[model samples]
Target: MHRFFISPQNIKENTVCIDQEEARHIEKVLRLTTGDIVVCFDGTGREYQVRLEGRENGILTGEIIHTGLRESEPALKLYLAQGIAKGEKMDTIIQKSVEIGVTAIYPVSCERSVVRLAGDKTEKKVHRWQTIAREACKQCRRNLIPEVMPVMNFTSLLEKIGDKPAIMLYENEDTNSLKALLQGEQFTGAKEIFILIGPEGGFSDSEVLAASRQGIVTASLGPRILRTETAGLVAASIILYEYGDLG
Candidate 1:
């Protein structure tokens, strides 16, 4: 069944109404009509099996046949605090990260970052990335949509990281590897794990130290260095696999 994420306000009693963009897609593109069944989620860890009842004035209403909790989400809450990359690299990162089950994404502005977003431009880009995340979730069958946060500077990003278990991926680090760290410790019941990846030029020594002061452990992705976009995806996948979500 096709799945879509809708707001809770659209759902009430035994009926759910899909408006605006989703309604247009169903009526004009998919051509799904009355009696067709589709699965819809509200991003609150619940999905409803609804049967289309009618469409009028660009609004599609369906009768809720069943409602249940979503089980596909991983037990581990994975958060990605990635340095903003240039062009399509950021888009690819957000899309793939959501597919791998990241809980949320923070676009951090690092010293080496080439793309700098500010004012209205930053808001527009964030909106675009969020749309990409939503589309990716639909394609990947994810019940919850990952949030693409407003871009944050290196120092500002650190303040919000708090004391959670975090790993900052730095190429210079040779002693601690993500694999080695996970293999030795138990993270099965950990509520959240933060993964930070630098931009094209990677993080400077000073930036690494700043993150370290905030209780984030600096780690490497092994001997071979991965690109800014590839690093975070690989890290998230590895963490998910280690925690048994990939199996």
Candidate 2:
């Protein structure tokens, strides 16, 4: 069945409204007729099995057949704090990370970050990435859409991390592997987990020290260094697997 993310307000007692781009997709592209079944979610961890009632005006409407909690969400709340990369790297990272079950994404501006977005441009970029995350959620059957936060400064990012159990992926780090860090520590009942990755030029020595001082563990993917885009996905996958969410 086709799945879509709609607003909670659009959902009535027994009816759901699909409008805007989604309405266009259903009416013009899919050409789904009345009685055609489609799954709809409101990004609130609930999904409704609805039957198309056809388009009314510019909006497409559907009758809710059943509603239930989404099961695709992982039990762990995994957050990815990624150093903003250049070009399409950030886009790819957000999309794939959402698919891999990241709860939310924070774009950090490190000393070595190549692409620095500010003011109006940062807002626009954040909107674009959020759209990518939503699209990825639709593709991955994720009931909850992960948020792509506005670009944050490296220092500000560390401050926002608070006292959460977090780890940073540092290319220079040789000893503490990701596996060893998780295995060595007991973080049971940790509802939230933060994973940080550097940009194309990687993190500077001072940034690593700052993160380390903020109680974030610096770990390595392995001896082989992965690109900025690949590092987060790998770390998130390993974390999810370790926590019993992935195989």
**TM-score top scorer:** 2
Reference-based TM-score of each model: 0.94, 0.96
What value does the lDDT take at residue 115 in candidate 1? Answer: 88
lDDT of each: 0.88, 0.90
Clashes of 1: 0
Best by lDDT: 2
Supply candidate 2's per-residue lDDT for 72: 93
lDDT of 2 by residue, 78-135 (tens): 9999999999999999999999999999999999998988899999999999999988
Q: How badly does each model clash, as a count of residue pairs?
A: 0, 0
For model 1, residues 1-247, the per-residue Cα lDDT tens digits are: 8887788999989999896788778878898889999999887678899999996565779999999986888888999999999989999999999999999999999999998888999999999999999889888888788889998998888887888788899898889889887776534457789999999999988899888877788888888999999999999999999888985
Q: Per-residue error at 3 for model 1, in Å?
A: 1.5
Instruction: Indicate the worst ten consecutive residues by lDDT in candidate 1.
Output: 182-191
Model 1 segments more than 4 A misplaced: 185-189
